[model samples]
Target: MVASTGHEPCELGPIDYLVIELPQGTTTLTEQMTDQIIRSVSDRTLRILELLIVERDGAGDLTVTEFEELTDRGLRGLDASLVEILAGEDVHNLASAIAPGRCAVVIVWEYLTATSFTAAVRASGATLVAQGRIPAQAIAATLRGDDEDA
Candidate 1:
């Protein structure tokens, strides 16, 4: 059996999550990164589906803080709430991965769907064969002319 959304399917781009650790003594997100997200969303390059900050104490206990709570708790300049992004279990899993005495900023975003391009591909009967990502380290090494054979 397959599940559906009770509506027609829509073209969607890739979704990815990044976990950025705030080192000890750092409590808030940097303005630079916030501006980047704002710029991307404004330009229609990507959409932030969910954003969260999870803190872990010295005893490895997780403190779950909702994105909306941050707005109330003084996470300045951020005024959006994505309350229904991920399931509770998913949130827990992300929090569990955080190291003690640190907090993680998790951003789940999707590249804006290329609606016309996808439609054109479908009309041309071109089916997706495979999809994968090359690690950034490999790309960096290739760009730097570093030998990857060893």
Candidate 2:
């Protein structure tokens, strides 16, 4: 199910991408969806940060800016919510308060999706089926809390 964007071809791998078209004058959930996705991704990112702090030696004392620089790989399209959360006072202060000898370290995994991709499509008020790279088996495993290789 390939839905043409009428632009360059988007290679979505094997996952089925649904391009839902919103009807004329249809109510959009773009803001709501963006909020939800941002929150979820931010929370996950925070968790990863916490884990990194725990794993690295003397990593509890880095500044927020330092952490941002270190983890700046895949945050290209993060929405404002995520940026705010990352730059919040608490996070900044925490990074700054690390022990004198310790440096803050954060390990980030690859983010597979963009913050605005789904929201913008939803806002466009259109529905169409498109092909993606997300494997159905992987999605099922995720839903079941099983390993993807299982």
Candidate 2 lands at a TM-score of 0.21
Residue 31, model 1: lDDT of: 75
lDDT of 2: 0.38
Best by lDDT: 1
Across residues 1-150, which tens digit of lDDT does each residue of candidate 2 receive? Answer: 122458964422122112222233332323454355346557643212221231112444333333233243344344322212233454444444344444343323223354245445655776447634666778888889897554
List, residue by residue over 1-150, the lDDT tens digit for candidate 1: 111357866565666777788878765567777778777877778777788777888998777666677653333333452335688788778777788899888888767755456656666888766667787888888888887721
Lowest lDDT 10-residue stretch of candidate 1: 72-81
Off by over 4 Å in 1: 1-5, 72-83, 113-115, 122-126, 148-150
State which candidate has the highest TM-score: 1
Clashes of 1: 0
